[model samples]
Target: MTIPNLENNRVKLSLLDLSNYTHLESIAQQKDLIYYSPSDISTPEALKAYVQTAVDGYYHKNTIPFIVFDKISKNYAGSTRYGLISWKDKVLHIGWTWIGYEFQGIGLNTNMKFLMLQYAFETLEFEKVEFRIDDRNQKSRKAVEKLGATLEGVLRSDKLMKDGYRRNTCCYGILKAEWPEVKEKLLAVIG
Candidate 1:
């Protein structure tokens, strides 16, 4: 899959690959930021392996991950991805999102989501884009809701977390028909 480089005024989202391993690893190691990350990226070797998994997923047509870059600060903010893509169903899932501790509470997450959502809805013409967050991650749930995605429900014991616990997944989604209003709301906040 050819994941195009996406950028807006505030942020740039580039495809995540092996070459980005070191840079992302450094960001992942910053001040407990990796706690919520799906992979154990605390060390360089572990981060390299994680990146390889994402790259392999891309080759297998299962996922397209991106490195989030802060344009104004000219720094790597974090990472996010479009996973579980279903071309036949015109649907996709967006998760595996992490913003370094320093970058949190700013509008970087909002801007990043806006760029991805716009591309998913307008460029890819997907009928639906989904977000699944660990039920315990209140911050992520709130962030996804702020983007105008409707919470569908929760999937209990959906997957095993890195901590060795079965996590309940909170599911949310934005449909194509709802994109216009969502886009407007996102733009309003981004402005």
Candidate 2:
């Protein structure tokens, strides 16, 4: 489970593991971001399990997760990942993203996404990158759309939330052909 460290002028994406639980827990408590996720990481034990699941996913080839770091502030902002990867299809899903409330509205998300898209499209040569948002998460839906991802459709009852309710997922995608334009747009916004 060697997750590469990704960086740019504004932020860094470090490989997340059990060792990062304390930092992640600190950020998790200071923000409401984790409320939307299926994992309950509010406590030390829960955070450990949450990270272990992600680590397991990495070993299973189901995901590669990263801890979002703000380079300028030198603080942990949140987390994001490349999940549901299909090497044969040259496609990967990017979701489970969250930025601490204090860091939201800044350019961290754009910079992080930019680095990821660059890696997925240029380095890995993925043909398409997908994003799935809970239908009720308007903030997430807007953020994905802002990245120039086209709305594909909805997956009814796609996931079970921590609240014991099924969540409808809104699917979005950005093809390699659309990367150049999206990249340009992101650069402008990130700047």
Candidate 3:
């Protein structure tokens, strides 16, 4: 099932592909854009490979990746995705989100996430959505927490990072039942 473009006045997310490499090139090279993760998109080749992996996952129906466009700034931002999809279990993870330095703290991310969460709970009929964050990434952990996702638990030394470090993963989740309240809060902020 193909995911259509998810858009609002704040941000637009289109299915990510190789062609998106150009749109993202302008914002992908900033220092530590995604230093917590293993994937590196600092160079042209690395960025292409990164997008290619996401595209391949889409072909395999394993993830729905997106290239972010900040409509307010009128500029391409970065990327995110709905990953680790389990159709039978009706659960998926939302993480791997990164934006340019200029895009940070702009509320674009909250708007974008609100749209995705609404779609996942209402349209896709998913039972739950999860987020895995590096424990040290307080910025992201707090962001997701603000979205009303509960801190479920932590997986210590769960993931390998580019810096040859094994990072602790903090698991957060939003049950479908919790979406109504979360949506209300997000709407108030978005408006």
Candidate 4:
């Protein structure tokens, strides 16, 4: 996919790579920032490995990872990605997203999601974008709901968490046909 300046006044998104991996170090050490995640990035070494995994995904041609920058706070917030991308199906899934505790509730996520959703639907011309959140992650689920993704279903014991507990994954989706309305809602809130 072609990429240019991916900022929306409030946030910026750049391809996550080794050169930009240091940008995420500042916020990635926050404990339990992504408690629901199967991987641990709470330490510097682990965070580097986490970034390497994203880079690998990009090379594998299944995902596009991004390092998020919060312009309002002038901070490199965290990371998010479009994974499990299927060009044949015209669909993509957005997951592996997390921001620092300080960045939460600052309208950063909304602005970032607005840009991502726009890119997936309008620019890439994907038919559907999906989000999978752990069932116990109510905060994340609600955030995606705010972006107009509907709960499609739940997959029990879907993923093994870092804490050694299995999590039920909640699948959410927003179709291309629904983007116009979702875009309006996000614009209203972000504005």
Pairs clashing within candidate 2? none
TM-score of 1: 0.95
Query: What is the C-alpha lDDT profile of model 2 across 76-172, one tens digit per residue?
Result: 9888889999989999999778777888988788889999999999998999999988898898889889989999999999889988999898999
Q: lDDT for model 3, on a 0 to 1 scale?
A: 0.91
The residue-by-residue lDDT of candidate 4 on 1-191, one tens digit each, is 55555788899999988898887886888878888889888888998998898889898888899999888879899999999999899999998999989999988999888889999898899999999999999999999998999999999999988778999999999999999999998899988
Question: 1 or 2, which is superior by lDDT?
Answer: 1
Residue 71 of model 3 has an lDDT of 90
What ranking emerges by TM-score with the best candidate at the front? Answer: 3, 4, 1, 2
User: Cα RMSD (Å) between model 3 and the true structure?
Assistant: 0.8
- Candidate 4 has which clashing residue pairs, if any? none
Candidate 4, which segments miss by more than 4 Å at Cα? none
Q: For each predicted model, how many residue pairs clash, with residues at least 3 apart or on different chains?
A: 0, 0, 0, 0
The TM-score, computed over Cα atoms with residue i paired to residue i, of candidate 2 is 0.94
lDDT of each: 0.87, 0.86, 0.91, 0.90
Question: In model 2, how large is the Cα lDDT of residue 49?
Answer: 82
Tens digits of per-residue lDDT, candidate 1, 1-191, equal 57778998999999999887567776877766755545777788877887888889899888998999999889998888899999999899998888788789899999999999999999999999999988888888899999999999999988876878888889999999999999999999999
Give candidates' CA RMSD values in order: 1.2, 1.5, 0.8, 1.1
Model 1 — which ten-residue stretch has the worst lDDT?
A: 30-39
Q: TM per model? A: 0.95, 0.94, 0.98, 0.96
